[model samples]
Target: MNRELVLAPPLAPPRWYRLRRQLRDAVLALPRYAALLLFGAFTVFPFWWATAAALSSDGAGIWIFPAAFLPNDPGLRWFGRVFYEMPFWRYFGNSLLISTATTLLVLLLTIPCAYALSRMAFRGRNALFVLLLVTLMVPAEVAIVPNFITCAQLGLLDSYVAVVLPNVAGAFGVFLMRQAFQDTPAEVLDAARVDGAGEFGVMCRVAVPMARPMIATLAVFTFVAAWNDYLWPAVVLKERLKMPLAVGIFNDLTGPFAVSTNLVMAAIVLSVIPVVGAFALTQRFFLSGGGLVRR
Candidate 1:
């Protein structure tokens, strides 16, 4: 009787069972996946359109009227005009210098300040953070008058110093650094201390490495903000030669008898390349979180 017993191989779930599970997963994912795709397209389409427009010929009527999604005759003619007809290179260089300097100085100041705020517990620390948050809520226009007056008093008007100095110690950078530093493990710091490392040594060796992602993120933010800044430079810098690319580009767009749309688009393309290149280069740091000031 025991030898007579037989078994059938386990059959795959009834086709409907497998189908039902797949259907459930698809249903659950549909809205989220759809939303993500839609948002991505929304954000990216304008840049694609801009690139398309930049490649089109001047006075060609491709971008006018109803606006062409694809150019009729794509050429580098506008790009040529950007370089040959305008001081495009000079403005680009000035923007690069200002943005680079601002980013470097902000990093130097914010890293230490954030470490102090995060690691060193003291009176008014929370208050200081709260004050910064409050300041963030207030529009930049609120402070522009006083800032302008101060710059004038310092005899910094129409100078690079006027543009770069005001932005050196940025509230946003300090806030970002502080938040990032707070996430560093206390045990790690204690171990460093046990190894006879001083505060600065521990910060360089331990804290900085852990906060690299946040730092890269901060750098991207600062670089974009500085590069796109127009009002401050326009207000402070009266001379055309001293103006940053943003102001210069705006002047090119609005100051002429009839704006060359192609040249303006070319300038736009040129202004964007640096930021895009920078993001592409430093974006690796964002993923690796590698540049911690380690021992």
Candidate 2:
């Protein structure tokens, strides 16, 4: 007996069914996308408003509710005047120096301290960390009087060192670094020691290199804090030329911007550019898995 074999029609999903599945997935993802968009807009709107206000001629007809997104009459007069009307370049330089130096110092002090706290076995380690954590809870204003007195006695008042000295030993950087360094594997560090790498060598060659993401994160925060510092520096740095951008901008904006809204907005816009650029550059580190080596 011969058997006849026949193939049934393929059980493929219809085109409309596939389309429906895709639509469902997109609908499920829509809320997440919406949340991200809203957050982005919330974060970016202030910057956009400042930029738009700066470009608008005298910010005329733009300060009202439902503010104009685009300027009706844009001009660079305020931007040009920002430099000409005051000693802004000197202030900018002072801010650059202070912020950059503060960032470097924060890294130098924080990384080593964090490494020791995370890797070394020592007495009072937990207690010391707890003490540091307690310091973070203290309001910065409480330290202002002591810092001022110390600077005055040291004759560091009205100097760059005065401006930078107080901010160097930030607890936040150390805390962040400690968290980052703890994630590093001890076995890898032990292997490095077997290869004749001492503590310093291991730190420089291996741990430091691998922890770039957190380092960058701390650096950006330290830099921004330093750059935007007005109260402490203003209290310490009395010299007219020694003022940072924040102090200088606030000082200058008082009189001229009373007559023109554009000047005030322009100053805000300029003040933010350096910080925004720093953030944009360093954001890649946090995005790249917070300094963890994938391998």
Model 2's alpha-carbon lDDT is 0.86
Worst 10 residues of 2 by lDDT: 286-295
* TM-score against native, each model: 0.86, 0.90
* Candidate 2 C-alpha lDDT tens digits along 75-185: 988888888888878989999999999999889899999999988889999999999999999999999999999999999998999989899997888899998889888
Residue 206 CA displacement from its true place in model 1, Å = 1.2
Q: After superposition, how far is residue 238 of candidate 2 from its true place, in Å?
A: 1.7
The Cα local distance difference test for each model comes to 0.83, 0.86
Query: What residue runs in model 2 are displaced by over 4 Å at the alpha carbon?
Result: 1-12, 288-295
Q: What does each candidate score in C-alpha RMSD?
A: 4.6, 3.6
Q: What is the per-residue lDDT of model 1 for residues 130-163, given as tens digits with 9 covering 90 to 100?
A: 8877777878878788999999999999999999
lDDT of 2 at 178: 92
